[model samples]
Target: MSDPKLLLIDAHALIHRSYHAIERDLTSPSGEPTKAVYGFASTLLKVIKEQQPQYVIATFDAGKSFRAEQFAAYKANRPATPDDLKSQFARCQEFCRVLDIPVFALAGYEADDLIGTLSKQAEEKNLDTLILTGDRDTLQLVDAKTQVLMIMGSTGELKLYDDAAVRERFGFAPEQLIDFKALRGDASDNIPGIAGVGDKTATKLLQEFGSVEKIYHNLASVEGKVGEKIQAARAQVELNKQLVTIDRAAPVTLDVNAARFGEYERAPAVELLRELGFQSLLARLPGDGDGDAADLAAHAPQDIESKYAAVLSETDLAALVKRIKKNKAFV
Candidate 1:
């Protein structure tokens, strides 16, 4: 049987989660921020050790990619990342680079879109997939073969949600996320919920009606001003649903399987992590090591037919630097 190919990790989500987790104490040698970096590298190492898939891709949001054009209110409440937090992003990339991980992002879409596109692609190719993102909005993409690995606070616990799991958590299927969000609205994204309805009404209404459009099409039976509200604001609700819904049909240009795990050199990745002060991460690199990653994940790069060490590429390093400079815009 072919190895399962998993795509997508919310790098920033993990980074930020990591930062806050060890917020009070973590610091670098030169008196800089290391909480996020340390946490990020540790989670990455653990993830690698746990889900040693044949393919992997770590994604992050590009600067101002979709906030202005899409909703003009997207992620509006997030304060500017402090200089400390900003510094860690580079270290995060450095960590990925040392591990030979491929990270992708485009100018017009958020990481959510990238995750959506890539997840859909993996499903189309019949690959069992795991999506690691702190954002609950991504739960909409969960399916039988595609499960969302959502973080459970800072306890290092994760809830694996497939079709049944998603139903259990959200009280409905993945398709209901759009309508659910539309009714409750996303305060985090500055979206206004239906004036009176909250989670209770949203869940109940969507459970009965299935989708926002369907609910509106049969709005007359709803109680009080609720029916009138749906009739009056039909356009906004539909648009909100459109905004919240994951775009599974997006033309994903990345060949997810191309970022195969077996291609990476474990030793160098370990060495790199060590250099970045990723203390325990090296022990987690997939290889001849005796671990769960050894069984489910193929350790060595299949592309390397002969038992010879591969040549490292300087051009790859230079290209990565260029991308960091371009997207990060930090000196």
Candidate 2:
């Protein structure tokens, strides 16, 4: 059997993607914004059905991260979260809670850092880690035991990036991605790397020198304008490295067993979905309402690979309902 996979979700990235992917604004019965909530729920359910992971956890950015505190310009280029999307953040978190998934949100750490910490822990425990995120910074965490399911486009297509994929895309191992980003800088996060360096220059430099420190040691060998840029921006390059490197030892304690994807109670998840006006999703939950027959028919696993349906009729729904009878078990 394959090793138990621990799925770590970047809450804000997925929420932002969901909010924008959904063209029309959706609202709850009370008229509160529900677009992000619907998108997150739908995506989570879809992944759950497909991956069938034995564990799931979500990391959210609680407030200004340590990077922002250290560097005033960190993420400065990014706009403020939209009021509508902000309104749905709470509901999105509540949905995770209702699903019995463990959530980690450190006050001064970004979700990437928390995920880094957890992924490192998963490695120690010999568990496989899969990160679902749209952020490229996460690519730094991709290793043999840890892989990232990165969103490739606006259509929600995902590319599972492993060691080879990371090397192929970034032209270096996962360990050197921080150095590559440090050299090129990330305009999206407002991180200013070495002045004149860009992706091609960064990749070529890392390929030759292996790291920022090594590249500096061999600066004399590099000939051209790129050499001058690196010489002049030494301090900025170091600072950018500090800003881009993910802290794998963030001060957050996580119990691995607590994050195991156990059986979830259907009532609370169903109730939250109803509150968020996610009528279509209700069918995905076991014993959601009086629509057992309809739910059984609606979620009948047309893809066949889902294997969520063992039988064709109400028997399948009942069997699933029976399986999740335990408080912390999964159906």
Task: Return the clash pairs for model 1, or none.
Answer: 262-301
Q: Model 1: per-residue lDDT, tens digit, 171-214?
A: 99887897899887888777777787778888888889898878
What is the alpha-carbon lDDT for the whole of candidate 2?
Answer: 0.84
Q: Taking the tens digit of each residue's C-alpha lDDT, what string does model 2 give over 1-331?
A: 2577889999999999988888998999989999888988888877777777888999999889888878998888888788888878888889988888888898999999999999898888888888999889999998889999887667888788999988887779998999988888888999877766778888988889999999999999999998998999988889999999999999987687778775777767766776777878886653234664455466567855545445678988787777788555873
User: What would the TM-score be for candidate 1 when compared with the true structure?
Assistant: 0.81
Candidate 2: clashing residue pairs, number? 5
| TM per candidate | 0.81, 0.85
- Residue 92, model 2: lDDT of 83
Error of 2 at 56 (Å): 0.9
Best by lDDT: 2
